[model samples]
Target: MAEESRKIIHVDMDAFYASVEQLDNPELKGKPLAVGGGGARGVVAAASYEARKFGVHSAMSGQLARKKCPELIFVSPRFNRYREISHSIREIFFEYTDLVEPLSLDEAYLDVSQNKTGMPSATLLAREIRQRILKTTGLTASAGISVNKFLAKIASDVNKPNGQKTIPPEEVHDFLMQLEVRKFFGVGKVTAEKMYRLGIFTGADLHSKDEDFLTTHFGNSGAHYYKVVRGIHNSPVQPSRIPKSIGAERTFRENLSSEIFMLEKLEGIAEELEKRLGSKDRAGKTITLKIKYSDFQLQTRSHTGGHFVSKKAEILAIARELLYQQPLRESVRLLGISLSNLNTEQDSSAPAAEDVSVQLRFDF
Candidate 1:
């Protein structure tokens, strides 16, 4: 089975955006820098290692970051330049194997089980790829080598900033058992909090729970929790891991009772979805609308057999329709729109751009 024989390597760029800016401009090197427009409303896009030392990080409010590090140097993100470097790294990965699954502009999963170079060891290949990225892009990358995607991704993060780690097949269970539940891929802040309240703080705690019990508590994702706790993921390293859906949701600072305001927020989300679909050369047959109400209750509505929707107007129209079909039972805090049943061929035909798209589907 390709799943069982999989040789996955997770490659992560070190401080991707910030590193690129520093590389191109010597003045920014060895300084605390963040990539984003700096203002009261602006947030950090990428933080240099120096800035990280000051506890600054991406998605942190720009105003808050300024308060944390008063001397922080702010630079607007050069996405075009970052994309250029991302492209270069993508080419380098393909040179080793075409089974490349990019997670983001700065990270990717490469399945080199059967590589172009006929390399028998994926670890050696990961080392070579890291070196090549440094030479060509003037940037450092970290890598993790394992038999599966889950272990490989965790290994990559274990050694930070220009390092590599490997977890052998025999050590998978032990490695996972020692990990904190919060560090698990699928465990977000909300989920982690729930797990904490349940007295499950580590992978070991999760492993102790029966599969049926977890499923009863966490729903479908609980089954995933059971497998990941034992390092038993069976998902493949898909070569064309294209976006099957595009959607955005916001957790409200305060829950809204107005249906009109919720619809207005959905409009913004629809526009964002439209732009994303237009930017990527793919069409979808399904439009899914998700709403999370104030009580944390979640529900999704989807429409199928839709047109080859590439334009925002069409996508929004469908999403709006699906959204209205359901009643808001409680005050809503989050809304999202997604297009699924993808057309991969459309994406492959697009002009190749760099910066791997890293999609962290923690739900598996």
Candidate 2:
């Protein structure tokens, strides 16, 4: 028997944080605005459409953003307000289907193949969802409708800032063939450059390369590229997806070479990780340390303990070991710590409220 096709929709809010600020403050609308810290070492969390016109964007340094748009108004992010709005939006989604996978506070992938509305057309459903969001939240959202998550996500960005696009199953092949290699999902700058060097500038070029050839050139991910280029993604929209890891990272204004300075930075990173784990009431067995050198090279080191680790002291101790286990290779510009192999089961020996514990494991 032939397989049944799935209907997927990817919804993305337009400049969510900055737009929320503008919605609350009417005077801020139509002006260049950014939401983030305004300190010299601060980064822009979000930039309004107006700010983007002046080349301002999210994750840009406050100093550089100001230089780009001298009149850019910087407003601190109100995460609580955003969360409230997100909850309201999610309620709207549940009205359609329970199979909703949230990517962030403002974006989600919805499996609307079997929906409550009994709507036969995914495009119509996307339009209805976008309209409902605008009506209920006083915010606009863009949506993409397709047969799978990968195609739906790409379609959503076609006509952005309050628009919707749908790629029917029959049109998938031609649409993908014309797509630029860089626009495909998971094709970052490095991968795109590699493709360009290999004369794979478009999906058509990528499609011409056989599975074996791509695998030889790109490893396991090469097989993924081979499938996606031919419009053959089968990844599902899983609503119950739990994060495999939690992490915190920071980039310094100046690179540090001294071991003493690196340790001090690791302490702060560990504290941040502890706070994050505490908020989620989560503990993990493996701790991974990530470092980015001034030249942008990245390195990671991990140690898995026998017991779950969540406490500040435990996290700090593990992080300290990971940092000093190896000699400094170069000046470091970024530092990060992450916890994986999360403990989801309850423990009886540990405290009744916080039953988190750890077990020793191998280190590499």
Candidate 3:
């Protein structure tokens, strides 16, 4: 089974949030548009290609984005409408195979080794799915077809914003050897810097290292890197698709040096997060606060309490306290508030008082 060829496809919506805004407001099409909560403290949700040309991008502060692109238009995110479109896309996928693993509202991975449609070629299946998405939802999606998730994900971006690419088995080696190390999964800013310092700037450089040497430097993650460098990734496609939590955050245009500014940002994030939780009819026992410094250093603190917290005030209070407790040398450039340890079973559906007090443990 491990040696057999696998049929994997990665589908990603093009400029998802910004595109949705343009779709609903036809006049905004082909213009620079940014989807974000509008406030001095709000963060960008997405930036259109015209906006990108001006250096505007997601996670950027609205103020900075405006400075970069003075004509950048801001539109608020409409998640319900986005969700409606997402559901339609999911329905299209189910027509081909149930082995669809959604990464988010805008991206998914499908395993079509043995598809419901009895298709012999995964590339053909990818094209059909892309066409169906466009016919049904007035939107464009890019797809990548390969033998595994890693290759498929990279191939998908080769020709983006409404394009498809395929990497057959014969071309896998040449494709991987020339691939940049930064494009490898799990290699973010910090990891990429470390790889560069070690003279492993590309996949070819990484492949030249002894596996044991990589393990010594990076532990378990190094093993992942080593295998990927050799074009060997066997992770399974997971499709159960239940979200464990939901949250939102923002990055400041300039470093936030004052508590007043930070708290204000936290309040807006908490409000948005609570709205999402309320819509899902979910509550969480754990609240987490994430901070990222200007240097890209990141830290997080989480608290698990007895009460299920769904109120904005409660979340903000906890986040503020966490922010205060952190020892800082540099000003914070980004702030994130999240809730986990979720209890999604309906409160009414739960057991009696004694049962309500019972704690469930997951061994995984």
Q: What is the lDDT for 77 in model 1?
A: 90
Candidate 2 lDDT over 152-252, as tens digits, reads: 99999999889988888777888988999999988999999999999999989999999999999899899889878877676678898778899999899
lDDT of 1 at 57: 96
**Regions of candidate 3 where Cα sits further than 4 Å from its true position:** 37-39, 242-288, 292-298, 302-325, 329-364
Best by lDDT: 2
Question: Evaluated with TM-score, which candidate comes out highest?
Answer: 2
What would the TM-scores of all predictions be?
A: 0.78, 0.85, 0.77
Q: What RMSD does model 1 have?
A: 7.8
Model 3 residue 256 CA deviation in Å: 8.7
Candidate 1 lDDT over 1-364, as tens digits, reads 1223567899999999999989999999999999985774466989999999999999776788898999999999988998999999999999998889888899999988788998787778889999999999889999998877888999999898899998877677788888999888789999999999999999999999999989998998998898778776766677777676766666566678887787788778878877777778767888888887765578999988745685767877787788779677988767888888777645556864332211121111
C-alpha-based local distance difference test score of model 3: 0.84
Candidate with more favorable, higher TM-score: 2 or 3:
2
Over 233-255, each residue of candidate 3 has an lDDT whose tens digit, in order, gives 77667788556677888877778
Clashing pairs in 1: 86-355, 87-354, 103-357, 103-358, 104-356, 104-357, 104-358
Candidate 1 vs 3: which has more lDDT = 3
| Model 2 lDDT-worst window of ten | 355-364
